[model samples]
Structure formats: structure tokens, C-alpha cells
Target chain A: MTKNDLEQLIETHGNEIYQFCYHLTGCREDADDLYQETLFKAYEIRKKIDKSDVDSPLLKERNYVLGIAIRLQKNLYRKKSRRKEELLDNEQFEYQTELASDFNTEEKVEKDQILAYLRKIIHSLPLKQRKVIYLFYFADMSVKDIGKLLRIPEGTVKSRLNAAKNALRIKMEEKGYE
Target chain B: MNNEEMIREALKLNIDAPEEINEKVLRNAKHKNQGVVFFKVATLAASFCIMTIVGTGLIVKASTGKRLIEYLRGLIDNRSYVYENGTDTIMTVYDNNGEKWEHVEYLDDEVTMSHPLSENETEYNLYLKVTGENGMEHFMNVTAKVNEGQSSEDLYWAIRGDFYRFFSPYTAADEKSQILAGLKEAADNADKDFIRDALIDVSADLENNRRILYEDWPADIWGGEGRYIFFEDLSDLPVGKCIIIINTVYDDEDSFIFEINIDGNQLYVNDVSFNKYSEEYYQEQLEKNLPIYDLR
Candidate 1:
């Protein structure tokens, strides 16, 4: 693929990719770094695909780019784990508050609170379950697609999704949510 | 709301990336692409130069002459002497005691440089096996910085970093003797607490020394507890016959064997022997359902 093709790909799918990165990292700074590194790696390895494949569907290109983002995020997670660094919980709470301001009504505020709580819970999930949750719910990917992207079986993807949901349900119940 | 709807709703809110990110990513992508292009061009140019020099007879001879000149310059530099004998490039450097040491920089089959270069700044903690004047192998841990632009040869000569004498059976006998005295005194008093404390101190020292020697401790052997030093049941033995065995499993197939022999209040460390086992032997023992420590 040419640089022009990569430029267009990023232009089209940059927001979704960045959102996936944010959900993966739970912080804007790490999301930014992961996003930039993902694009740089995609550009570096662009020649791996045939030039004629440039005419492939936009969905395939988006998945290709997202695949790079997933692998890089996994590696970043591994390095961070080695260093024993935890994600900034305060950053997530601050971001949720900032996001809550955009909604005006009391019902919207309540919904935003629930959403923020869910986000925190999701972030606290183990890496595998969190990844499955992000790709499935946020990225709008199918179980099979997640399996293909993560190189796991579809059954494993379904199991992870179920396990993540169960964990979220347990946390929500503990917080006195129905 | 249901779980799926709640999750989708939560993820969808404020999902847009900061507006500047697109431009930043594009700039980074372009910059990285340019670096890749430059690297490819440089590699191609170097390959072409080498090919041309090899293709021309007089240029090859001139290249040899240039190498000889570099070798002669190295000989005069007193700090180091670099010369090629047949296929091996040997670098000679004098130790602090004025003893000459020759390291083969480039062998015929492989490059045995002391340090390898990486693309980014990497701090390498390495255990260097240096043969002392007594011809006994002594292991020392050295931390070296290998910057991106620096070559391995430069790193080999300019390794000025923190060095720790990681335990050698021969050189560190005096230190071992001190530990033995401490253990003996604690044992003679019939102070089990002091004995345990002494054993714990020895365990901590062994953990630090072994951690430097082998960075990655296998999680299976450690049971993910992150503890390497295991003490055999010290409570069962009597006071005078208190034999403390400190077994440190450094890797799957190797361990640092430390034995404290306290026969009738005479305490001494037998030896700090680093024992290694072959993979086949380890697997065979595993198949026989024997404990890993028994394989030693």
C-alpha cells in the first residue's frame, strides 16, 4: 500500500482506532501514544500487503489497521505489566466527570454516572476479558471477527465475553445496581 | 438498561479522539516512513560499495591496506590493540594489574562481541565470566548502556558502569567464612530465632545474586509466588544438628545449591555450587514423577 492509501485509511478510521486505544488503556496519554505507534507500525509494514489489495473493501483495511492496534496494545500491556504499573484510576474518574458535563438533564446525568461506573468496571477487568469487551461492545466486532483478530477460537471469544459480563454484573450488584 | 446497551452507551460517549491526533498521527507516520526509506537507501548504498570493492582487484587490495593501517593505528593507541589474524579480529586490552587480555571480536563463524547493539537505548545487566589469575572462573554482574548510534566494539572497550561481584566459590571465600562465623555463633547459643534470621539473610543475598545472574525466574517453579529461596523444614531438626538447606531455583533446569552444615553446633556453608541439568534429564525425571530438587 502507498502512503496515500495509509493516509486515507487513518483519516477515515482514526477516531474508532483512537477510541479502541482509549478503552484499551483507559487514559488519553497512553491512548495517544498507542494510536500514534499503531499508525507508524501500520505504515512501516504496509508493503506486506499487495499494492493491488489497496482496492480491497474499506472494512478489511479498517480491520487490518485495528489488528495492528490490538497487537501493539498487547505488547504495551506486557511491558507495563513487567514494570508493575497500574492504570491511573483518578484519570478515569476525572474523564468521566468531564464527560458528564456535556449532558444537561437529571436523567442524562444518572445515565452518565452509570456509564462511568461501567467504564471503570470494564477497565478493571483482566486484559483478555477487557479486550474482548472492547472489541465486541465498543468496536462493534462479531465474536468470530474478534477470534480472527486475536487468533483465538470463536468459542474462546464467546467464553471471554461471557466471563467479562459476569464480572461486570457482579461488580454492579455489589454497587447496589439491579 | 441491559448490559449490551449500557456497554455500547458507555463506550460511545465522548469517544471521539482529540482533534489534533489525526495530524499528529499523520506526521508521525510520514516521519517513520522517511526513516525507513533512508535506512533502506543507506543499506543499499553500503551493499553497492562492498560489491564494487569486491568486484575490483586493486580496490580489494586497497581495502586490505586500509584495514592494516587501522590495525597499526590501534596497536599504537596503547588503550587497545585491534588486529586480524586470518579470519579472527582480536582486541587486546590490559587489565588494572597490567595483565594482557585478548578477546576475539570477530570469529570466523560468529561475532563474539561483548555487547550487542539495539535500535534504542537499552540497559543490559550481564554476568561476565572472567577467569582470574588463579585460573578460576569468577562471575561479575555489569550494567552497560548500549545507545542507538554506538557500535558494539565501542561498547566493549568503553564499559564504565556499576559492577558487582556476584558470588564466586573461590574469590569470595572470605565473605563466606564471615557468614559461617555468624551462623556458628547463632547456632552455638541454641538461638533458633537467630539461626532462622541468619538463614533468611543468606536467602536474601542468594536471591539478589541469582536475580542478577538470571533475570527471568520461571513462574512454574516459583508457583507465581515470586519467591526463589525455599527452606527445607528447619523446625524438625534439633538445635545442635540444625542443618539449614537453602535451595534457590533460578530456572527450570538449574538451581543455586546452598547447604549450611551445622553438625553439633559447628555451622558452615558447604559450597555455593551452581548446578545445571540437561533438558532431557529434567523431562525424564518429571516423567518419573520425582520432585525437581531431587534431580540435583
Candidate 2:
């Protein structure tokens, strides 16, 4: 395939892939960075891609660029500890912060309390446990997929998830929150 | 502890993605297309050569074999095997790790895991999700309708990457992405219930997918050329009639719930359990077998 084809492919899938990166990473800046990184990697690997592979249905559509973007985001997610990535949108960020503060005072708090409680439960867990829980629960990914991305065994994935759930349940019951 | 409800609720919540990402995806694909043609050609040539050699051999073997049912079931349901079968014909589900999900919820049909299935319910929503062998996730929604004996819907979500045949008619990818993106955009600020309803489905179709296994091919299987679903129209069946089929292509696990409803004229059956009559429960069903459909 020629460089021209590469440009067209990028023009097609670039944004959607970027969106996926954003959702996975939960931050726009990182998503953008990952998007760049994915395209850059694809560029480097183009030598092996082949002229015929260009029109091959799968290649013409989604391929390693996705794999690369997805893997890169997870890699960054695992490595970043204590790095509070900034929310690029300031108004929504501040609004959320204000809501968190106001939530402590609350009206109709009992009705919506579960939402906040779940968030607390998520926040209270250890990072790895929380990561596994959110990835499974919120993202709805299977443990095998989580295991592969995390380079852990599937059993370990289940154990981590089970442990996360058990911890949450105990905390909820003890606090009379359940 | 049906936290499945809570989990479902959580998932139904939408996350907003930036608009420019689609352009970015196109940009990446275009860039990758450069310099990759040679490799693509070489691989195609190699694939052709290999197909010629094995194709004839496979056809002959297939002709002589016991139809891969036994061998494949053992392999696919192998309490342990893990690589993707991408036979796309297989519709088995798995746990977070790649093991088959043994979760079973028996229903009224004498269904096998290998046949194309068409189920009629007041409402059907099937969500197809894939987790990376690493933990990343992707999903599409398939919906079917069975009213006045007709089912009109079978659509699946497709991202730019999963959409094959960009230039060919097989390339339903672009249309899928447009739908996906539009849905994502259309979803802005809509309540959770609205989004969940948007994901509802009514048909389950896959052409001889491995996920569905039938003791016998029950004279009906759905087929089409897209990555989503096939819904044989249900407009002619008696309004109150029910036939349970399993087209596991869209679903890999046995943990699905089918809910049916017919107001007044029809007898209501919501998730009718068939354990008392299924062959697996034959020791018990032998006593009550004829009494079942005979009630009609």
C-alpha cells in the first residue's frame, strides 16, 4: 500500500478510535495522545503491511491500529498511579466537584443515595481491585479480556473481581448502606 | 443478589465521546493503508495457495466426517481451550477469561446449541459484548420484534475497525458506524431509560454458528450477509403462539432471559421453564412429555 492509502484509512477511523481511547482512559488528553501513538505505530509497521493487504476487507477497515490504540491506553492506565489526570473541560469538572460537595448536604438524598454510595464503594477499594471492578462492571468486559490486557491469568482476574465485590458487600452491610 | 440489574443499569449509562474521533479513525486507516499493500498481496497469494492445498482436502474430509458436531462441541465447550474460533458460526459465550460460561437458564424449547433460533417475545434485547483477551470491551445491540407474527429488526453496532468490506457491498461497516455515532450523538442528555430502550433487540440469527447447537436442524435457520442478526419475519404466526429457538451467534452463554407477553387473547408465559419437559430432564419429562404441547 502507498502512503496515500494510509492517509485515507486514518481519515476514516481516526476519530472513532480516538473516542474509544478516551472512554477507556476516561480522559481526553490521554485519548488524543494514544491516538497519535497508534497512528505512529501503524506508520512504523507499514513496511510489513503489504500492497495487497491494503484492499483486504479487514485491513481496509479496522485492524492493528485498533489493537495498538487499545493496548496502549491500557498500558498507560496500569502504569499511572497517583497521577490525577486533569479533566480538560473545566465547567463540567467544576460542576461535578460542586455536586460532590452539595451531595453531602442533600435533599431527596435517600432516593439517590445509592448512586453516591456506589461511587464511594468504588473509591474506597484498593486501586487494582477498583480497576478490575470498574473495568468489569462499568465497561462490561469479560475477565479473560481484562486478564489479557493486564497480563494476568483469568483466574486471577476472577479472584480480584470477587475480592472486590466481597469487600464492597461487607462495607455496605457493616455501614447499613446495603 | 441480582446485581445483574445494577450492573445493567450502570452499563446503560452513556458516556459522551468527542465528535472528531471519527475523522481521527479515518486518518489512522488511511495512513496504515500506505506501504501495506505489498504485504496484503503476499498474504493473499499465500492464503490462496494454502486454500487450494487444504480446500480440497477439507471438502473431502468434510464429506467423510461425522459433521464436526461431536468433535467441535468437545473442542468449543472444552472446559479449557482459548483461542478465538472466529468461525463466526460459533455463538458460545465465556467468562472474563476465555472459558465457556456454564450459566444456564432453561426455557420451554427443546433447543440445541447449534441451530439458528428465532424467539418470539413481547420485547427482546440482546447485547453483544467482547472483552479483549486483555480486558478492553466492545459491544453491539441486536433487537427483534414479534407482533402480528412479523419481526422487522436485526441490527448490530459496528465500529470502524470491525466493519469489513469498506469498498465492497459487504462493507456494512460505514453504515454501522454512522448508526453508532448517530446513536451516541442522539443520546446526548437522554435519560438512562431511553438509551436502554434504544439497545433493545428482537431476533437472534447466525448462519450455522457454532454457538448454537441443534440435536436436529429444526427446518428453520436465518441467514444474511451482515455482522449483526437475521430475523425471519414473524407476521403470520398465530398471535399467541410461541416457538423457542437458539441462535447463539449473537449470544455465547446460556444466561439469557426471554420474556413473552400477549394481552387477553393469548396465554401469558414469561420465561416459561422447561426443565420438567426438556430432554436433559428426561427422567422426569418421560412422565409428563405428551401432556405439554398436547394441551393445545
Candidate 3:
């Protein structure tokens, strides 16, 4: 692609790719990194373009960008088998913003305390469940999409999400947040 | 619970990942390309008989010509396009960290797609083509609303308005689709005007990091029971205020009064977060998405 074409690509599909990365990685910083990696992959492979082969550049780009993102994420996790990294739980994520209200707000204080505990629980989940929880709750990605990224069956992604949700809900209920 | 709803809600969790994932991807892609010298030579040796042709073949012979409605339904539902490797000198930007970004600009050109509104004949088919990202073009067929006895002109404008509604989201004018989705929620609550004309913008106090606009709304627009004020593209709007244009077209105005439910979020947000198909997965999804006919 020439200067003009590359400019057009960025002008057209930049943010869309970023969002895809954001959901896949579960953090703004990670999304940006994945997006950069995906784009660079596309760039190196750009010479193979057969426009007639694909009716829409955006569609082609979406597929390519996402394909790279999934593999990259898997590899990243495999390399980091040491640290016991804690994930952000749905309850804490939901209430993290409402924690600083005035002293008179009894309901708000209770919500804040509950959320703080929820964060602690997420820190204790297994790695796979932790990843599943982030993708579903924070990224809002579809199970089908997650399945594709993980190279797992859609049924698996669906069940993983369901299990993750149930796990969170149960934890919340155990802590009396439901 | 349905897989769709479960998947949708499950996508809202807060997951943590190891840092430096991006750095590894760049190194990986680069390393993979290093071995491309052998991979390319091998693929080239087999390219001729393998794919039959360098491009995807999608020609179907129909005695009665193309079935507009069926063809359209397939395209829209699959969300699959002829996947191609971008053949140009792909100019890409990597923030010092190595993430890809394609900046989107509002190109005012209208993408016109028409299909036969009548199902009785194959000649009346839908043809749709729109301009967006270079390779992934969006194709959709318009359904007939003749049942509602809508005037072609009113239906046209409403659809045109809907096109605006659909495209407005990508242009970062979140109001058109966001309000419509919110109103659909209200319609679920049995609000009569939600469909006819109940779209509104409520982006008042939000500025940074606010994905959806946050604001208060009055009971009605200028006392019109079903009037609507929609935001076309307000990405550049001041944080405290949003811009909106009002539209008040009704079903009675068209002989073919039709109702369309635009999947505005998918159409605009490009939320392919969950879509798992790629050329790598294509050979696999193909077995599932379509069954190959062994004519041999």
C-alpha cells in the first residue's frame, strides 16, 4: 500500500481493530499492544493483497488482525507460568467507581466493601477461569469469538463463560452481594 | 439460557493478562517472516493446482438468475467476505509498543444496496454495496415493507435515515445507534413511539473514557408525542453538550410501511471481539460454515 492507501486503512479501521484487541486482552494497555502487533503483521504481509479475493478490505483486515491477536495472547500466557497474577472480578469492577461517596450513604459504603472483597476472590481463581472471566465481563466479547481466538469449540467457550459467570455469582452470593 | 445471550453477558468480565504480550507478538511475526523464505518457495511451488486460482471463486449458476433475498440473507448472516491477503504495500502504524491502528475518517459517500422487495419473483432481488475499510466491504439486502403499504419515497427516506443511523456509529456519532438501542429497550417496555420516533441523545457530563453518552432527557421533543432528536456524528462534540438532528417520518407516509431493526452496535462498533474466523481458521470453519460439494 502506498502512503495514501495506508492512510486510508488507518482512517477507516484503526479503532475497530483496537477494540478487538482490547476485549481479547482485557486491558487498554494490552489492547494497544496487541493492536500494534496485529497491524505490523498485516503490514509485513500486505504485499499479498488480492483485492478481488476479498470484497471488503475491512473484513479481510479484521480476520487477519484478530487471528494474530489470539495466537499472540496464548503464547504470552504460556511464557508467564510463574507469577500468580490476580484478575479484576466483576463485582469489584462494577462497584469500583461508586466507592467514594459521602459518609451518609450507607448503601454506597456497603457496596464498596462488597466490591473490595470481590476483588480478593478473583485473585484466587485458576488461570483459565481468570482469562475467561476477563474476556466475558470486561471485554464483552462473544463466546464464538473467544472460541475462535482460543481455538476451542464454541460450546467450550459458551460453557467457560457460563461457568465463569456462575462462579462469580456464587462467590458474590457467598459474600452476600446477590 | 440461549448461547447468544450468555455469550453477550459473559463478555463483560475483567480479565488480566501477562504484560509484554505485544512485544512477543512483534517478535513472533518477525520470526515467522524470517522463515517465510522457505514457506513462500514451497507455497509458490504448489500455488497453481492448490487454490485453482489466486482469488476466491464464488460463481453460482442459477437458471432464474441470482436470488437477491437469499444471497443477501447469506451475506448478512455469515458476516463473511471473500477473505483476501492485502496485496498492497501495507502502511501500518505501531505505537512505540507495536499495536496496529487504522484511523477512520467519515467518507461522505453513500453506499447504496438494493434488493428485490418482492419475494414472488427472482427478478426482484436485493443488491447492496457499501464503502468502508479497503478489503472488508459490507453487503446487505433491504427487505420489503409493502405489507405496511408504505410510500416508496417515505420508505426510501426512512431507510436513508437508517443508513445514517447505521453509519453514524462508525463515524463516532454514537447517538444515532446508541439512542435507538436504548429506545429499543424502552420499546420492550411498551413505549409506542420508540419505533416511530423516539431516539434521543443524553451525553451531558461525560468526556474522557465514557463509551456511551451520559445525560438527562426531557419527556418529549418540542411537545411532539413521537418526535426524535438523533445524533449523526458527534465524536468532536464538546464534552458537556452533544449535537443532534431531528427526524419525524412515520409508517403512514409510505404505502410499504416497513420496520427495520438495525444491529447498530455490530454495524458500527466493529465488535468482532468474539468472531473467531480467519484464513488460518477458514479451512476449519469452512467445513462448518459451508459444506464443500464434491463434483468430482
Best by DockQ: 1
- Taken over the whole model, the C-alpha lDDT of each candidate is 0.46, 0.35, 0.35
Residue B111 lDDT (model 2): 15
Per-candidate TM-score, first chain only? 0.85, 0.47, 0.54
* Deviation of model 3 at B103, angstroms: 44
Query: Which residue runs does candidate 1 get wrong by more than 4 Å?
Result: A47-56, A82-85, A89-103, B18-21, B31-296
Question: Where in model 3 is the C-alpha error above 4 Å?
Answer: A1-32, A47-60, A84-146, B1-296
Q: What is the alpha-carbon lDDT of model 3 when measured against the actual structure? A: 0.35
Better of 2 and 3 by DockQ: 2
- i-RMS for every candidate: 17.5, 17.0, 17.8
B12-130 in candidate 2: lDDT tens per residue?
32344344654554454553333111111111110000000111100111011222222233111211111111112223432322212211111111111211111111222222222
- DockQ of structure 1: 0.16
Query: What tens digits encode model 3's per-residue C-alpha lDDT throughout A1-178?
Result: 3333434555565555565565555456556666665565454344333477634755544554455555455434333321234243244335555436565377756645655555445434544555555555544456766664444578877776676667767776786666
Compared with the true structure, what per-residue lDDT tens digits does model 1 show for residues A82-175? 2324555455443345545544677887776777787888888777788888888877888988887676689989998998898889999998
Q: Each candidate's chain B TM-score?
A: 0.19, 0.17, 0.22
Our tally of clashes for model 1 stands at: 0
